[model samples]
Target chain A: MKTVIINYGAGNIKSIQFAFKRLGVDAQLSKDPEAIEAADKVIFPGVGEASSAMHMLKQSGLDRLIPKLTQPVLGICLGMQLMCNHSDEGQTNGLGIFDVEVKRFSKAVKVPQMGWNTIHNLKSNLFHNINDAEFMYLVHSYYAEICQETIATSHYESEYSTALKSDNFYGVQFHPEKSSLAGERLLKNFLNL
Target chain B: MLTKRIIPCLDIKNGRTVKGVNFVNLRDAGDPVELAKQYARLGADELVFLDISATLEGRKTMHDMVLKVAEQVNIPFTVGGGISSIKDVDDLLHCGADKVSINSSAIKRPELINELADKFGSQCVVVAIDAKQIDNEWMVHLAGGTIPTKHYLFDWAKEVESRGAGEILFTSMNNDGTKSGFANEALAKLAETVNIPIIASGGAGTIQHFIDTFKIGKADAALAASVFHFGEIDIIDLKKELKKQHIEIRL
Candidate 1:
């Protein structure tokens, strides 16, 4: 499969590419719309401030092209948060791929819920062989509230969408690339799908 | 639920692991990448590579080591030591390092924290503070706790957080090699003082120490070197104990 990880000068895309390489797939990093459109699987990744990342997306015009793609797209971390309707981080609007709004965790808990967390309530084939309450590494300050598009839930202060699915589009707040064996399995499932 | 993290820190010099790591069935124990892979397989939540290389050439080799580790290992790892500028962090991240921990450099110029946080986002920026208690005051130290600085531990932590640091890796010099236990009193104070995650480093000799750090210190993560390197504690066994204690570990 021709896998292309959209690189728009956001956060670290090399780790994602390396994860695919470890899985025996040489995923290409491309900002070229044509190369991305031609790929069988497209991986959308982002790390950093929402408004700036969105601004970079607009600069490269991937912002307009990503939501319209038909192939199975996986958005990770801030990439997943940017797929929603809007984010409270920097007061930026998302691509509206997932019907949810992103909000920051309250002071009752840590602002950025870092380290490993369990994802349960699996509802999509993206999870496939993954068991419920499996550990996945997550590092984020903002999160999307549980909604219809939420395929998996994790509790920090309360339940929030850890993974979301809208038809062919899949978004996970956890870094499957950095999530060890189970994360690798999820990526393999995505490739199979 | 977000489980506590167990990190195994590897001290690197010229891209080679400095301390002797006794991992059975490993061909080369000095190779950081090999050791990192072993740690990931052994269920270490995260890995920290503290590059202690002094020469420019040694620093250059760290990049290659990072690339190799990122290529072979799937778990998240952070590269630290001698990282002073945005270019240094950029090169490491491009080499596939999940995060870059800044120590003396961030202390030297506090603006470096804000600059990094603004450029790379706070998630990728980790500020490592090495401090020791002096006359009932936790004073931040430099050069691996040799040179004392005027900044207090809690004040420095709060400063870094206000400057947009994502996490703080606090190592108590007094408790580091002693391995009696983590400085839970200071750690708990730091956790309450900052809104971001706190990584308690040093003084981890047993499984119970890990438990105390998490429960008493209220640390989001605990980091150790000798205990893990010398085979004094097995990560799986320790995590199992933590799980049994209802501490929310990823066993």
Candidate 2:
């Protein structure tokens, strides 16, 4: 399956691109609407603050185009946060597809959770080959709390949605691209979808 | 879990990697960009390029070289030498460098670390402290291990972290190029004193040296040069060796 990775300048797209390439899948990078619409699968990978990311997406009209997509689209990290209704990062509004709000983790812990954190309560197709409470790489301070769309969960100071799924739309708070074999397996399962 | 990193140090003199058994031969190893690409492909968790040649001519090429190597490889890389200001850090980051290391500049202006940490966040700035066993004390050295500073390493490491450096890269000049294994005592002290990650640099010869650095030295990472450049230990094989020893690796 051809997977199109949205390259909107804020994401760590290279690693994700490389991950797909390593899996022998032709993951194309595109900012064009037709290319994205034509793809069988899509992955939205992002890093940086919500406000700036929203600005860039709106500039390219991707903010609207993404929600209309019917094919499977995986939003990673900031990509996942951006798909929600709003985010605490930069006090910004998101695409509102998931009807959830992203809030900042309490200051009781560190800002960026920069190491291996486990994903419990596996409840999505994304966790097919992965085991419950599987360790995945995490690198964000803001998180999406458990909502109607929540599928898997992790916690820093309190429980948060580590993975969310709604129809063909899926979002992962952790980077499957950099998470090694588990990450590779997730991407492979994505291709099979 | 995120694995402990294994890095290969490439001392660049003019966009080329310089290698020496005891920092004396100074012969060319190859192109820095090619070596960096090879290392990344061969399972090097990270790469360190120290600009040994700070000549006016070489100085300008450093940033271009950084961009060149960063473009070819998709891995966390750090560039050091002649970094003095936040603007320098900005330039390197714009060139796609993941981290910037400060040497003499940090000692000359300790606040530069704070300035960089404040601007780009602590994750990008790495404080490279080159120290030596001087009179039974670990004294920080500067100008590529030529000059000395009053900053005792153990205390200075605490100070650097407070200023917002993402990590501390401690190199023992006396053991550098000596291949006598890393300064275990120095590394252990720095690791114990600092809460952040500590990259052990200098005095790496064999695969065992890398192991000992993480095991006995308690280093978060190990940086070596000749042993890596000369193919004494291939990076992938080295990581396999490290993994066998129960050390975490990306593989």
Candidate 3:
């Protein structure tokens, strides 16, 4: 399988690569458009500020190329926020893969909703072998508001979309790479799909 | 709501896990990678690997060990001990560590914390404080809890958060390895003082100790080594007990 992890220099891509390697799949980390385009699957992962990540993506022209990716593409954490129409973080606009806007959690609650939380109301094949009430690791301050494209929802002071799927583009707000067995199953489901 | 976290700390020296792990189902007893995978299977919220190796060659060995563990484990793992600069953090993160914990170096030059937070986001930075209670005041210790500093524990914790630290791992040297319990009073004080989450480390002996750390200490997480390393405490059973006690744990 030719899987390419879009590296725009925003967050740690090495862990994601290692996760794939353990699955008996050798995934490639590439910024070259040709490698990304020719891949059977593309994983868009990020872990930094939305505005800066967007700037880096634009600089590398991945911002323009990402939304055009026809293969199955999965965005994680900041990658998920960037797949939205816009984000409250630095007031940045993102790829319109999902028609949703990212908003910061209320100051009334903890800003960075760290630790494990369960995802339910599953609506995608990405959760094939995963059961409901399974916990996943999450660390983010901003979250995408619930939308029609939402495939899974979680709660942290309020209901929000934890996973979203719009056509070939899929995004998960939590770090499946850091989430244990169920997370591995979810990634395998994505790959199989 | 986000649940309380349970983290098993492993001491790695010269590329191998020290103090032979005695978990019930551990495949390879002294292998960090095998232990990591077993911990993830047992539903440990996270893992912290403390590199006790001091020499340059040992550091290289530690890096190779981290790469091996990362290749096998799929959960968040943190690397700490002897991390001195941006390059060290860069190398570890590049080797697939999810986060890097800064200790003595962060105290020697406080600006190192800011530099790391700037280079990698604060979420990737964890500031570990080793403190020894002195004269009714918890004084911060440097150089692996040997040299004492003038900074107070609560005050430095607040400063670490303000300076862009993602979280604080507070280890009470007096309470560490005692196996009686965690210093809940000091942990509560630090938790109240900092807006960021506080990970309470040291002196965890029983499952009830973990309970007290979360409820009384108000710690976001609890870290222990010996009890977990020696098979005295089972993480899954501990989580089940925490859940029964309404401590809000991931089961």
Candidate 4:
């Protein structure tokens, strides 16, 4: 199956590509709308500041195209935050794909909330054979609040949405690419979806 | 809950993985890619590659090694040593390193932290501080804990956090290579000083040391080179012991 990872000069996309490569899938990195639209699956990846990333998306016109795609699309890390309705980081507006608002984690916890955290309340085929409370690597300051689209929840300061699903669009606050074996299984599940 | 991290740091010199005792007396470990894959399989939460090479040619080899490791290893890893500019970080991150830890370079130019955070986001920027207690003061050191700096440990930590560093890796020269324990008192103070995560490095002799680092040190993560490289402490067993101690480790 042909897979394209949306590249808009954001965070590391090579790791995502390598993750898929290890899974025996040669995922293409493309910023072109046509290539992304032609893929069997699309990955929307973002890293860095939200406002600037949103600016790059608008520059490349991906901001308009991504929300309309019908194929299964997975957003990872900042890409996941960008899929929400809005983000508190840089006061940026998101693509409104997940119907959630992203807010910064309270100073009560670490700002970035680095390292591994467990995701529970699994509710989608994206998890597939993966069990509940499995740990996934995460590094982010902003998180989407738990809502109707929330497929998974993790507690840091409090319970927040770690994974969101709204029809063909899916977003995960954790980095499945860097999340080890259980994460690889989730990517495989996305492929089979 | 976010689990406390267990990081096995691999020191690289001329493209090969080496472990130095007390920042000197180097010993070869194995291929970096092979060692990284082994550590990931063994349940290491993350891995750090510190390129101790002093030559320009050796730094070039690190780029290739980073690419290979990123291709093979499933978990997250950080690349450090000789990284100073945005171009350096950009090259490594493009090569697929999840984070880049800056030490002496960041100390030289504090704005480097702000530049990196603004450019790549703070999540990818790790400011590693090497400090040791001198006259009852935790003074920051430079050049892998060899050269002393005027900055205090707590002051530098808070500065890095305000500068937008995502995490701080504090290695105590006094406790390092002792195999006795980590600098729990200093580490706990650093954690309290900054809201960002603090990774405690240095000492780390036994599984009990790991427990103390988390419980007493209050470190968000613990990093050690020799214990893990020499197979003195098995990560799986260490994590199990930490979990048994109610330390919230990934097992």
Candidate 5:
């Protein structure tokens, strides 16, 4: 299977690529819209600020193509946040894939909720065979509020959406690539789909 | 809520893990990739690889080693030691490291902290400080604790946080390798000074030491080398103890 990771000249996608390789899938990283559109699957991964990432996506012309994708496309970390309606990180508008907004965690909890946390209420096939009480790695200050599109929810300072699923589109707030065995299994499930 | 992290650090020289571990089970203790795999399987939250090598060639070798480890180990890993510039951070990040730690170089050019944090988000930059208590003052040391600096532990920690460093790794020079305990007093002081997460390094001989580091030290994470490397303390058992003590830890 040809899996192409969206490369918009922002953030490092090496770990994401290695994760797929470990699953015996050689994924390609490319900014060319044709290559990404031609692939069997596409992964949109990002780190750093939302506004800058959005700006880079726009400059690379990916902003116009990503939301239009019909095949299964997964967004990880910042990529997941950017797939929402908007983000408060830099007051930037997102791709409007998921009808939700990302907001900063209040002073109730730590700013950047780093480390392992459990996600419950697994609803989508994206989490097929994934059991409850399984820990996924999360490292973000902003979270997508619970919405109808939320496929999974996690408890932090308050309950929020950790994963979102729409028709042919999947997004996860945690880094499955860095979450060890459980993560590998989730990727395998996604690939088998 | 985020669980407290337990990190096992590996000191590498010329692409091989530094030797001083007394574990006989590890036939090739110098192999970092093998040790990394072992730690990940043991339920370690994260891993830090410190390249103690001197020559440029050795640094290059460490980069290659990072690639191998990243391919096999499925956990967030941080690389430290001899990182001097944005180029250094970029090279390591490109090699698949989750985070890059700067110590002596950060002290030499404090602005480097802001530079790195700006280029790569603060989450990717970690500033490591080696501190020692001298005359009732916790003074910062440079170049692996061989030299002392004017910066105090609390003062420098606040500065690093204000300068946009994502996290601070504080190691007590006197307590390091002693296994007596973590410098809780200084750790508490530093934690109060910065809102960012503080990783307590050095010491940690027993499971109770880890508990105290979180409870008393107010540390977000506890880091150790010999205890985990020499099999003096098993990570899974230690985490069980931490949970029993009411400290939140990933089991």
Candidate 6:
């Protein structure tokens, strides 16, 4: 199956591409709206400033094309936050794919939780092979506020959405590419879908 | 909740894990890849490989070792020692290292932190500070904790964070290899001050020491070398004990 990873001026695109390559999946990366919209699946990944990222997406018209995709789509890190209603990172508007808010972690928990942390309260097919308390790599300062779309949850200063799911759409705060076996499982599950 | 990490640090010389009583009289611990895989199976949250000779050798054999370790385990691994430039970081990350740590090079050239952070993002750069307490004030050390630097530990830590360091791996040179306990006072000071994650290194001898580092020191992670290599503390039992102490872990 063909997968198009949105490459709208964000970092970590190569790492995610390399990860898919390791999994023996051929996923193309593109900024062209046609290539992304025509793909069998889509992935949105980012690791930089949110406001500028959305700006790039809007400039490329991808910000509009992404939400119109009928096929299964995945978002990672800032990509996930941008799929929500709004982001605390740049205080900017999002694509509104998921009915939730992305807010920054307070000074109490520290920003950019960059390491291996356990994941629990998993509630979606994305975690088919994973279990409660499984460690997944995470590195983010903002978290999605809990809503009907939340599939998994974690806590630091308070309970928040670690994973989000809707029909034909999904997002995760953790980088599944950087996350080890569990992350691989999540990607494989998304592929199988 | 993301699980708190338990890390075992290895100082590799000539591709073999080595340890000493106090950063001297080096004794071989084991092969780098073998020890790293062992830690992974024992539920270590991560592994740190500090190349004690990377700077002198001018080659990153540690990166090669991390490539092998990454293939063997499903956990994250960080590489330190002898990282001087963005090219050094690029070589290591390209070799499958999850993080690259900077120490002496960063002290000599603080801009290296900003450069690496801009190129690779702060999530991949870790600044290691080997600190020694003097007159109740912690000072940064360099040259494998052999030389004292004028930079104050806490001030340098905040500076690194602001300058875009993703995390700080704090090692107490005075307590290193002493097997007594972590320098919680210094760790708390750093953890309390910075917005980045703190990995407490040096002087970890017992499982309780790890617990102490996180509980009192408030470190995001704890790194021990001799205790794990010498069979004093098994990573598996250590996680079990940490969990018993109400600390969240992968196991």
Best by TM-score: 4
lDDT of 1 by residue, B62-98 (tens): 9999999999999999999999999999999999999
Candidate 2 lDDT (Cα, 0 to 1): 0.81
Worst 10 residues of 4 chain A by lDDT: A98-107
How far residue B230's Cα lies from its native spot in candidate 6, in Å, is 3.6
lDDT of 6 by residue, B104-125 (tens): 8999999999999876677778
Selected candidate, larger DockQ, 2 vs 6: 6
Residues A24-101 of candidate 6: C-alpha lDDT, one tens digit per residue: 888998988888878988999987678888888999888888888999899998899999999987799999999998
Interface RMSD of 3: 1.3
Candidate 4 per-residue lDDT over residues A120-161, each given as its tens digit: 999999999989999999999989998999999999999999
- Greater TM-score among 1 and 2 belongs to 1
DockQ values of all predictions: 0.89, 0.18, 0.67, 0.95, 0.66, 0.38
Comparing 1 with 6 on DockQ, the higher-scoring candidate is 1
Candidate 6 regions with alpha-carbon error over 4 angstroms: A3-9, A12-39, A55-65, A116-121, B13-16, B54-63, B66-72
How would you encode candidate 1's per-residue C-alpha lDDT over A51-135 as one tens digit per residue? 9999999988988999999999999999999999999999999999999999998999997889899999999889999999999
lDDT winner, 1 or 3: 1
Report the candidate with higher DockQ, 1 versus 5.
1
Candidate number achieving the greatest lDDT relative to the actual structure: 4
Error at A66, model 4, angstroms? 0.6
Cα misplacement distance, residue A29 of candidate 6 (Å): 5.7
lDDT of 5 by residue, A1-193 (tens): 8899998866769999999999999999999989999988989999888998999998988988999999899999999999999999889999999999999988666557778888799997888889876889888889999999999989888999999998988999999999999999988888877
10 residues in a row with least lDDT, candidate 6 chain B? B54-63
Chain B TM-score, model 2, reads: 0.96
Model 6, residue pairs in steric clash:
A117-B2, A117-B3, A118-B2, A118-B3, A154-B1
